[model samples]
Target: MSTLVAERQLVADACRVLAARGLADGFLGHVSLRVDDERLLVRCRGPQERGLRWTTPEDVHLVTLDGEPGDDGELGEWAPPNELPLHAEVLRTRPEVSAVVHAHPPAVVTADLAGLAVRPVVGAFDMPGTKLAAGGVPVYPRGVLVRDRRLAAEMVAAMGNRPVVLLRGHGLTSAGASVPEAVLHALSVDRLARLELAVVSAGGTLVDLPAEDMAELPDLGAGFNHATAWRHELANLP
Candidate 1:
């Protein structure tokens, strides 16, 4: 496939993966890829509007940073997602990032609202995720729809240099150099959230892995963490 075709496929598949994994409920979430300095390929709610689980490559639209469709007007009856700024601002601010995923994972929202921030609760459960949690996940205090530049800037400020940022009661925004990495970050964070809630609900206390064990965790590199894990997601998608 040509690069554009592949990118659209990636965006659509990312949404499908997120939906199948319980990260995005209904048709409210979006995934985006920086097409260049000025344009992007983002998931759009096409006329069929079957929601994320039913997303197909045709549902992806090529649009400018301002959320305008490409000259062909391929957008047709659909429009870019309302929270385009959430992805636009991130791509504009973080030059190294090429993809962004905004998802409303139920466990993530519930855990954050209950004041259970993801922590380094275990070393072996997920090495990369444990490291991410140990680095401190930042939370954006607002729950309002981030549909404007200013609100998105605020979210970026809270995100800082982290791979993921939680948007209070809303959801999370994850950034990465590729679509797979971005989606993986969301999956990892959500997994941590679910584990946190499960432990707490079972009346167990979260104990951080000892500093030495954390220090011993090896960096498995992107090949294993992103490519391999993403393959697993695709294989399991129904």
Candidate 2:
């Protein structure tokens, strides 16, 4: 298959996976796969129903690394999300990131709104490398438009090497070496976010990872169960 065809297929699969999982409520979230220099394939934003599982290649717009829409210009029927810049910046800064997924999962959103510091706990999938970027996930205060060029630059600077970042009052940004890995990162955060909220709700003292556990967890690495998870989510799709 051509690189463009492969990219389109990857992005379509990503959207179906995310939407089925309820991570992306209708048109609420976004997903993209790297194409090549200065471009990526993103699902065009608009008119999607909740749990949409099939997005055509036409639905995936080839966008610039700067998040500019491609030569086809804007899709007459759809547009890129206001957050396109966030995805663009992530790919630019983290060359290892082949795919990016962002979603407003309830648990994560709750923690963000509650002003809780959601840190990684010692677990099979909770690795320090997944959480801390070269500069760390800087919280861009909510006000900037999702596509604001300045915000895109800040996102790149902030997400340096991390697999994931949290946008205050917005959502989580997860990236990976492949489309599947990015989706897995999103699930990992959603699971962790639920635990964080539970910890806070119960007023139970939450424990941070000790040095030994931190070292061990990375090796165990909660391998992403994309196929199983995707199947489960799709079955439950509304």
Residue-level lDDT of model 2, residues 1-238, one tens digit each, is 1337767766777787776666776567778888786878888765663333666566777777665665564555667777887888787777788888988777777776787655665355545333442123445556345676677777656555667777777787888887877887777666666787888788887676665765554333334355555455546544
lDDT of 1 by residue, 95-173 (tens): 9999999999999999999999889898877998999999989999999999999999999999999999999989999
RMSD to true structure for each model, in Å? 1.4, 4.0
| Candidate 1: segments with Cα more than 4 A from true spot | 1-3
lDDT of 1 at 22: 95
Local distance difference test, each candidate: 0.92, 0.68
The clash count of every prediction, one per candidate, is 0, 1
Output the worst ten-in-a-row residue range by lDDT, candidate 1. Answer: 1-10
